[model samples]
Target chain A: MQEIPRQTEFVEVRGRKVQWTRGGSGPDLIYLHSAGGETEWTSFHNRLAQHFTLHIPAHPGFALSTGLETIRDIQDMAWHYVDLFEQMGWCEVPVVGFSLGGWIALEMAILRPHLIARALLVAPAGVRVPEWPYAELFIDNLDALRRLLFYDPEHPAIPQALPTSLDDPRMLNWLRAREATARVGWNPYLHNPKLPDHLDRIRCPIRILWGREDRLIPPAYAQWLAERLPAAEAVQFESCGHMLPFEQEEAFCQQVTQFCR
Target chain B: MQFFAFHLMPWDRLPDDFEQRYETAWTWIPNSLYEPGHGGTLYNRYLDELVLADRLGFDGVCVNEHHQSAYGLMPSPNLMAAILARQTQNVKIAVVGNALPLYNPPTRVAEEYAMIDTISGGRLIAGLVVGGGPEYYSFTMNPTWARSMFREALDLILRAWTEPGPFEHYGEHWKLKYVNPWPRPIQQPHPPVWIPGAGSKETIEFVAQRRFAYMGIPYFHIDFFKKNFDAFREACERNGYTASPSQLGWLVPIYVAETDEQAWAEYEPHLWYFTRKLLKGLVVLPPGYTSARSAATIHRALGKFLSSAQTRQDIEEGAYAIVGSPQTVRDRLTELAKWLGVGNLLGLFQLATLPADLTRKNMTLFAREVMPQVRASLAESGL
Candidate 1:
């Protein structure tokens, strides 16, 4: 696959300049990033770009985004993205979201079903299950967090992105991302109490992907989510953890591409 | 200097292999481990210590809130304050404090504080705190909203106490139709507000702006306390007010005996237990507990302190605690008080599993032998 030349740009959405990346040319495929903040364009983005024009926006509070002050909850973030779609002139785009972003994608689907033509939620975390609670990302130390997110801690592709120093910019960005996540997903814990009730409202076709070895949110949650949604399928990837995109990059992109097609 | 006898009221009867078995003493520690009969005795004994402190002429008896933890038994400090109000006379019953944000309407805090104040006949120092990071996990609270909720809840509490009731409160975090607290506080305006902080600049500013007494958290090194006190004083100066010594309080763990060697021999094990065992793997700050700037500052400061004090000798040299004979304790405290310029001293005599008799004796000795000398020294220095 030829590498897609990606360019980072700021798009003004509801008085906030949202930083986003764009590349490739085809059907609009909006990418939502996980809680660790937006990653550098990888082989996943490269492959996806060949099929669809990838519109990946750094979630409001991550990196250089300016919407942290305005976004209060996941619902607010859903609405912000809704406005982003309209402002960017994207109509009925296929949305692919990872982890925290997957939760946001679900919210978007519920809020405005028409906006998301198709949805692929990879290891999503927004459903309240009493038996299996989401692993606490906020409380875990950096090393523990990495272990929770990856199937193999020694994987070469797995970024060794621990904070170099207390004042490291990367550290600050990580903290900001976690802060943003807490702002949205703190009460009732990373899940909307009413999400299950409103699952039927999402008319768009949905694919819930989960890593078989996912420790952060159990694979059982994906099954539970698939059961709730009106039009949904749950697929589990073997030998992968919470970070499906990074762990099984080619397979994740292929699954997303197939679902979108 | 004013002295406060503070009790953590810890459940100290952990099995010998507790450190090896449990990851932490807080949050996820099994409830099955808590023996109710033992807990009952511990509570009674702890309360007895506080009452004894009152009888011994300690200025205040402080109780704090911690949930689902062997670290502190008092989940409801206000409840403890209410009991202390009736039992102890003369001593200020300081519920230091109710975690402001944890209360839903926050008027609950207002009503409870007022009730305690009324019962205590105005001898209440209302210590408002943005509960620690571990508390957010234990209470299942959002750390991002902790500061905002604290500010909003504080505003609501103050209004509920001072403003004529039946006033509607429509804030971002809480919406209340009628915040009409029945019993207003006995203190004319309100009780003296003391806020405990772990040297966050924002907290220092917030506390200093209101001229509330800023109580330094006891866990950090003496140098950290000095730096934080200086920062607080600077914050006060920036607010165009010269901070009085009374505006600052230091929470210190102290153990006094007839001889320095005796004090160290007895206190060392308990202090080590409190520091190493009960507090192991407990620095879990819920994301967004502090702003990025504050967190960075804390991390930087903590890194330096932790690096320096990896050994017991380093900890002792840092003066994290004062354990000595009455004269030695008094001299050390006097030096600290003079250097830090803190008028209020919150002494934790009853630490993790320190037996009731020893706690009582330590309190008695400090009050009788050491307290007068410290006070006299401060007075002579015109502090």
Candidate 2:
């Protein structure tokens, strides 16, 4: 069967224009990318788009979207997403996030809990586990990324190197976006102590899926979260790492679909 | 239900004028040093209060570990456990946690835990943890290996308890031959292991099925604790067992003063130090070290929390320790316990920067005026 292209569109969010794409049709689902923006061409996103009307946005300041000057933090990003949802007339949509995107989705749940129908956070961050430091991703260090994100170093699925060279212009733009996003919200980075307070207010069902071997954010956090969020469920993917959506895409997409349905 | 208290030795004795002369004097110091009149002296008195807890008919007194952070001065909780062991006669001494992965020879944990267990006459609750992200950077361990090392260390400690005497422990992270923990714990099969988490899904499941008590250190707020308790309950149900609230414990920063208004007023400065100063630079997410769930969880805590003007007040309201009158505290604790379905309450009366006198007052009030009624109410309800 021929693969369907994701229907592309754009909307103004928080004073910046954001490019979003969609494909298939069912319940509305929003996809937020990690530090690395939308990789819709990848088979994982394509498959996700096949089942749900996947609305993946190139988060402001990321590639294909105008850089955001006023967007100061993840909450800014979260509020912008709420605006996007309002603009798209998505009163209640299941939102899925990965890595940094997961952080944004969590923020979205906290900031605009009413807008979400259901949510999934893959390889998310935020729970303060003892001494589990996030690896330094800057300075062209994929080795640190490999060691930090993967549970097993020998796991065949982890890309041995960056999918594309860092110097590549396309890769450069993505890196710049990552840095800009990090700079605005970098100091404390991916957590709100108040979030634990606001979590109970998130009326929708929330599922936090963790890769057992994820080094960036340990699975232990899921346990921490499972304890705190009342309407929350947590599942651990033993064979996966931080990149659960991509590392174990088929299983991930299937689980999400099943949960959303 | 168990009751406990904490004192993070914040030194207050150093001359205020000393800072004018020396650049380093004004620099942030560890919580261990006793301040001349208030910080350190009060801590010793706080120790006396723990002894008083034993006298006041409370069940336990708790302490914990932290390093380089003024927030928690007890770098070696084992040491505090020893002090409490010698001073207090009857109350259980819970070293609520020791950072496991930070220690080498994992046997050190096995040894220390055993020592504390024996010293306390088998009254010890060994809390093992991976020591959060900041401790990882402080101890210079690869955040990537923290979970495996932490879990392995836990396994080794558990094995040391059950496996007869000196045996080989072969672990991918830790390789120890003839692994023997001397003075094997006074409590057979090890002192009860309780896991503490700010929030972690892995911790809840691990502690729940094992029937080990799970502690939620929701430092600031009570709201999210409901979710943690709920998740813990669900995990229990999934395992075909109903989790009683008694199976869970929660740590709250509590201060009980003469009046509710006085308590909040007295607690303001210390609480600010606890939230802002001590927490500054403490938030570090280096990347690639946590599981998928962690990275996807909370992206930034400080910036998000402190973005607006009322941030400080918001944090204070959320803090488990804001000072309140005895009746108010009792009411809050009662409501919180029933809300979270928790039986054991670990009250952190002494914070990193709170004066000793203030801390002691908080404890003494809780013990003398507040606790009896709280217990009576729970007993009355058969909760």
Candidate 3:
């Protein structure tokens, strides 16, 4: 099978331009990235794109997206993405979200159930399980943050030096993304108090995936999520930390592909 | 030159191996280290020092807010200000100051500041702050929204003080229906506003625009302070105003004794405890506490100085802490004032583990021996 070339495009909603990537040729599948912000098309994105036309968007205040001032909370982000979907004329699209993105995806499903055909949440955050609370990402230094994100701190998948050089534009983008994440996720500390209560509003099929060795947020949260959602399935991967898609790339893509099918 | 005696009121009773055992002296340091009985004694001693400062003819006695830390005992600086207002006479009781974002209504700050201002006969220098990064973590305040919350709260408070408000305020963070505040401040057009900042361009510009007295934190090198003061001056000029010397203040830890050698011997341990044990890591600036630009500026300016190998001699030489004989202290301070062009000096007389007697002695020596000499030097220099 020949690999499809990814094309970048911008969608404007409420006077703010949202940057998104598109590839493959099938039913639209929107990919929401984790809090660290979206990376360039990785093997996982490429593999996932083979099964569906992937529309991966950099969340507001991340990368090329604008209007950080307007986005106050998770709900605002959910609504923004929903606006983007409506502008794209997308209907009941299957969504795959990771970490912070997973939380946004779940919020989208809850806000407008008819807009989401299915959701694949990988190590999603937002459901507050007091016993297994998420680690304080804002407080951790770079070394501690790296350790918390992966099962192996020395995992090659993790970018050793944030930017290869001082002039790298990605560095500023990454900082902006981190700041945006803090803005949205700081007060509630990455969980919505009312999310668990609204889980029943999500009418679409949901799949929760977790890294068994996740330290940022335990796999127990995945079980809790599954227990709450009316239509949900939960799975865990061994020898993986919070960065499920990167640590267990092949397995993660395969699970996502199967769930999409 | 106006001089303010500032007290951090540190709980000084840390174990001998505090640096070795604890990651930091703030936020997460074990609460068991804090005994209420010891804390009570420390508070009274600190208040007594402030009162003594008032009697000694200092212009202002300052207390600041900090949370979950031995860095400063007063979480409610207004309460301390209230006590000082009643007990002390002929001194400005500055709550330098309340962290606006931490309070829910924020009008609580306006109300309390008003009460203090009224009580002190218009002597409150209302210093508003966006609480430090550790405060955000301890209080669970969103670091990213701190600036916005702070600005909105400041606007609301100013209006409440100046604008005869029963009006409504609808801000992104705070929405108030009736913005009426009782017991309006005695100071006309509200109390003098002071803002402390660590060399952020935005802060300099904001302070300049508002004409608020900018207090520079002595966490960086003397060069950084000079640069910050120059930047503030430039900002004031750009904003079509000449910044008076009184508009700039330097907050520095000062220790004085009869002789230079004696001062170093007495102050070294406490300074070490302060710089090494109390100040550590990203605890001072959690992610998003400052804008990315300011964070980068902070990293560039203060990064090298944060290394653990920074010796007491290095700190003293860098003018982070001024410690010596009365003449030596006077000379350094005069040079600082002349160079920085700041008329106001906020001297931290009491430091980490410096006992009550020594603290009192230090304060007395600085006032009687050093302050007069500094004034004489400034006058002779024709500043």
Candidate 4:
């Protein structure tokens, strides 16, 4: 398959330059990145873009996106995304969110029910099941975190997706992204305490996707989260961890493409 | 020329295989390892040692904070400082201090510190710190906002001490309708501020800009201290002033005994317990705990540091701790103190597993035999 080139776009959201990427030709699909904000438009992105217009926006305080200090919490982040989308004239779009980004997507679907037509949440962080709490990603060493994040730490795509050493230029990006995650999720530890009670407000059809091997947040919790929401279903893929999108790239693109469509 | 006795109040016991069994002494270390029954006796013994330091004529006795760690028992240094303020007369009570950002309304720090300053009868050396990386983990504090929160907290505390009450504080991290703290610090213009750093350029600059005393946090190679002290002096120079010796302090663990050989036999195991076990994983910098530049500086300095001093020779050479006879300790301390150009010496008299009696003996022997000689030597050298 020939590579489909992506175009970069920027819009000022609340006075901070919010950057995103656009490619392919189809319905607009908002793609939210995980804690280690995705900087590269990888193969999975390209695969998804083949079927849908992928709008990958880096969260505030990650990579080229600015204005982390402007927002206080994940709710604020959801609002920031709303502002970004409104400024870019994107409304009532399908949203696919990964990990921390999935939490934001869920928050948006609940907070502004009309803005998201459907939501695909991949290992989202905002709802906690006491039996399977999110891993303490902030404190764990990199090697251990990698093992927790991926089913196969030696996967070929991992070197590009994750940082191995402080010497790597991507170290700063990882650090900044984790810092932002901590700012929002550190206290409740990736979950908003009240989010579980309010999960019923999200009217859009939602998919809670998880990897069977997720050690970060136990895979069983995906069904647990799905059971709480009004119109949500749980999906689990094999041979992947918390980083299901990258670890099972082909399956993820196919799943996301199918769900969002 | 000033000796301040410092105590980390380390847990008096950890299993001999603590290092092998546990990856870190902080945060997630199983709390079951800690013995509740032994805690009271340990706390009382640690307090008695600091009191003994005061009776032995030390200028100050210091207590600092740590959280969820077997490394140090004092999660609230202010509580210990308040006890010392009343229990020990004539010694300055230094709470080196409360981790600024962890305090909900930083006025809590202002109120508590003021109470300590007042309790100590104006003898308080307030040491502000951007807490440890482990603290960021333990407290769930956003490491990225650490410095900003620290700076803002310091400003709020200073304003609470200096400015009049009912003032509105509309800051980024903290917003208050009215900021008023009663029983303001007894020290005019607040207590002497001491900021501790481990060779972070931004920290040194922050200390220099305010003309606050800069304390070198311990356990690095002696060369690390040299580089940091030089950077500090250079920072002061940039601020259009030469940093006085009083503006610099070096914290080093010190032990004294009847002979050099006896000192080593007495102190070696405890020093190992400290470095190998207590300090393990203490330097794990949380994400965005500091600026990237400062993190790099710390990494470079750490590359030179003996993380867990490999040998007695490494310990001696790095001056990670000074253990010797009265004569040997006096000579080495005077030489290093002058060489480092520091006016203050915060000596850790009671480190990990040093018994109460031995700690008292070390403090007494140092005060009686070592401190006077070192002070005289420094004075003779016009330091």
Candidate 5:
């Protein structure tokens, strides 16, 4: 698996002091994580950084930044990226995300297609598959969750233990951010029910890659996108789960790099 | 043996005065074949019944997925499971789960199952199933993919539970570099798994391989279940394993009363609800909604029922409801237990819109009289 290089830095976007890390400057690649935060997207970012200038900002309330009261929801985070794009003066860039960040990328495309040259969402959320309830699975048992999310338990990427207690202050802060986002994003246990219809509104080319074993969001939703997204294509990763960005980091990066190019 | 019951609670009338704030926001595909009242009290009653079932002592309640029809009120069983978790206790909540091929990201199924397990104190029976035909219409998912996805989702979820964190899983249909899940299950290995079937040879063969409980949901005669149970046993024998009684179960439409006549009369309306309203609504299934095997099984079952024709006698003879007094129902149940050799009998007490008094009578009678007799008989037979 290929690894993306990581660097921490800050930049002045517009008048506000926003924090972002820029690596391997070329065509900028903006990376975002899901509500759980940016820790998971790092590998994908590093791999993309090798080819394009990878720019990953700690999404508001993520990483070290703490200016906002709460992350609000995925849409607000999408706007935050739009604001970042304007501040950085990037004419157009390829945006990539894993899980929740993938959902955010789709939202960003809907909000401003010009800002995003292209999009690659890995196991993205927001579209509800008729037979599956993505949001409701969060409340399901671990085993069912595993079977539902991942294609293979033998895969190297599936995690065994989840953080049980988020008592630490940093973890607590992370929880607050997640809670804010979930408050806005969570409902009906399905992804945004309206997402399928909205896909046509996104003009940029979209590519979705899913782990066949992705236990978190079934890859079938990706199929729905392929059918509905007017300008979308999708691929399934063998023996992967929701955490495909890290589990299949090399292939994930390669797929994104190729798609963006 | 362990206990499991399927409940789709009954709700008679929806209050007229309540604000219709949620009407436009929510739509229900009626269980009835024909579109009856578009999003009416009947829908609200279905939701109410599911929530109430959690409060009842039923081991594990059942909910199914249907599209554009209100036959089974829960189009999203997971959502209902979430609500039930908050409302009930100790009772195992079952969502017969998302029809795999109809689901996207399949992980949503994983996440929701995990979340529900965590919330329900590990009292979750992971009901993984290939959803029936109506689901394909609602989601427009190819049925061919549904079976494969169902298998793939099961494999992945099992791996997530037993395997260590942050692993990679890749498959042709679904792929992921990382299979790690945060907030892993409260259950050590995973929750118990259950599968509902319409008695397909492939399904019976498949469930027998895992020794997972096979829930026979024929919607008609107990003899139909006998055939499936026999097939499952045969499959087990072929696989070099002796089939255990606990591995089998049958879902019978149940209603009890002080007298057999009263039970039969009261149960007729509810039976009418399912046959006239519910089963009729499910006639049209989307393309690629069922496997060739499942389609064949459904055709066989529907053919049997259709051949019998829809009549007052067929409905009265327990085509959909098993109506009788305590001993009479017990005798019928005992005959079924002896013939099917099942350890668990999942009494589907709620059939459409039966009155609450009769519903309570049915459950109370079964718990008080039928269960004890059934357990005693199983013990005495020593099979």
Candidate 6:
């Protein structure tokens, strides 16, 4: 199958230039990215692009996104997206959120319950599992990050996806992404401390997905989130780590398609 | 020339294989490594070195803040300064300085500094810092907020010291209905502000613009120091004022012995331990600690910690440490100080693993022999 063409575009939202890529032709679906800010229109994005119109914003402060300084925390990030969505006239849009993006989506659902119609949260990190802590994302160990993100050591794209070279120009972009994540999520680590209490506000139908073998955020969190959010179901993928969407891309997309349809 | 004895008060007992075993000397350094029994002795011994510097004719005694590291024992430099202020006479007590962003309601820094200043007859050089990257990790602080928090905290601290009481502060990071601190510093308009920085252009400009004393943090090539010092002068020039010698300081590790060879032998292993073991994660700054441009510049200098700066020759080549006979030490320091256009010297006499006796003797020799000659040289050389 041929890859879909993606158009990179930008718009000013709340004094920040928010950059996102758009492609495909169907009902609107936003693909919120992971801590890595998943800029590349990869297989998961491409697969989803075929069935839905994909609007992937680089979550201000990721690559080419500006005005990250204006954002204070994860709550601020949710507001930025909400403001952006409101400006774009995007309402009742389904979102496929991955990891950090998933956490933001959960925030959006809880904060502005009507903005999102439904959400597919893949290994979302929003609450702490004290016994099974989220493996560190904001750290000096890129090797550990990659290992935590991927179940397969020999994943062909691991080197390309998680570049380790400091000298590489791509590192600056990666740094920007991580810095954005850190800005929003550093203090309480990744999860908002008050999020679980207000999980009842997430009125949107949600499918909380997790990799059973996830190392970064344990699969137990899927059940934890499922028990909290209103009208949410938990699903676990076999032989997958935190990279649930990438590791089980087809199965993940099939589930998304079924749920969204 | 002004002289200050600085002590890192490092835990000197990291296993010999620390470089091989530990990923870093900082956060996540197993707490079991710290023995309170030995720590109690180290604190006093280190303070004694600073006190001895005071008894001697050094102009000041400097202490700084670091956390969860063998790098320095003083997480609260103000405490050390309080001790020096009370015990020592005549010398300035430079808490060079407090990591500003780490403190909540940063007014406490202002209050404590003022208390020390009042108690010590205005003998305080207030050093404010945004703090190092590892501190952000140690504190679990958002590095993105670091500079903003630092600027706000600094502004709040200064106001708390200088402005009248009961004023309100509405900053992005801090909000106070009554932004005031009692016991405002004894030195009118607060104590002389000293800001220590590596070679970041932002820091140089920030320091130079305010004409605050900018102490160059040590452990880099002399050329890097030269570049930063030169840049500081240029920055001051851009600010439409030539920086006074009082506005520039250099922190360097200095040691002297009976012979150059003996100095090298005595200082080499300790310098190695200081650089190789204690400085493990320094280069790995958390994202948003500094602007990328400055990070590049700062990292370029701090990269020396991981470089081939292992042997004494490598150390000297980089000018990472200054160790030699009294004559060699005197000449090298005088020449460098004059060349760098700096008037204040913060010397770390007690490096990692340098014993108390050697440290005391080193301070004595420096104060007695090298200082007078260096001062005379610079004074006579018309610098």
| Best prediction by DockQ | 1
Task: Quote the chain B TM-score of every prediction.
Answer: 0.97, 0.86, 0.97, 0.98, 0.84, 0.97
Q: Which stretches in model 6 have alpha-carbon errors above 4 Å?
A: B306-308, B381-383
Taken over the whole model, the C-alpha lDDT of each candidate is 0.85, 0.69, 0.85, 0.86, 0.65, 0.85
Work out the TM-score per prediction.
0.95, 0.57, 0.95, 0.94, 0.54, 0.95
Pairs of residues clashing in candidate 1: none
lDDT for model 6: 0.85
Write model 1 residue lDDT over B1-383, tens digit each, in one string: 79999988997987778889988888889999999999889888889999999999999989999888888888899888999999999999888899998887788898899899999899999989899788898888878889989999998898888999899989989888988998999997999999999888889999999989999977677888999999999999999999999999998889999898899888878887787667765566678888877787777666544224454576567777888899889889999899999999999998897898899999999999999888988988766
Candidate 1 off by > 4 Å: A1-4, A24-27, A160-168, A227-231, B304-312
Ranking by DockQ: 1, 6, 3, 4, 2, 5
DockQ of each: 0.70, 0.02, 0.56, 0.47, 0.01, 0.59
Q: What's the CA error at residue B98 for candidate 2, in Å? A: 1.3
Q: Model 2's lDDT to the true fold?
A: 0.69
Interface RMSD values, listed in order for every candidate: 1.6, 10.4, 2.6, 2.3, 18.1, 1.7
Cα lDDT of model 2 by residue, A99-172, tens digit = 77877777777777777888888867654554666554432345555666666655565542233433344544
Judging by lDDT against the true structure, name the best candidate: 4
Minimum summed lDDT over a 10-residue window in model 2 chain A is located at: A160-169
Instruction: Put down candidate 6 lDDT per residue, B49-95, tens digits, no spaces.
Output: 98899888999988899988888888988888888888999999988
TM-score of candidate 2 restricted to chain B? 0.86
For candidate 2, the docking band is: incorrect
lDDT of 4 by residue, A1-261 (tens): 558889987778788887788888799998999997885788888888898888888888887788887767888998988777777787788999998988998888777788888999999888776777677787536788888788998888787678877677777777777777777887777889889888889888998889999988888878888888888999999888888888888888888888889
- Cα RMSD of all models vs. native, in order, equals 2.3, 19.1, 2.2, 2.3, 19.2, 2.0
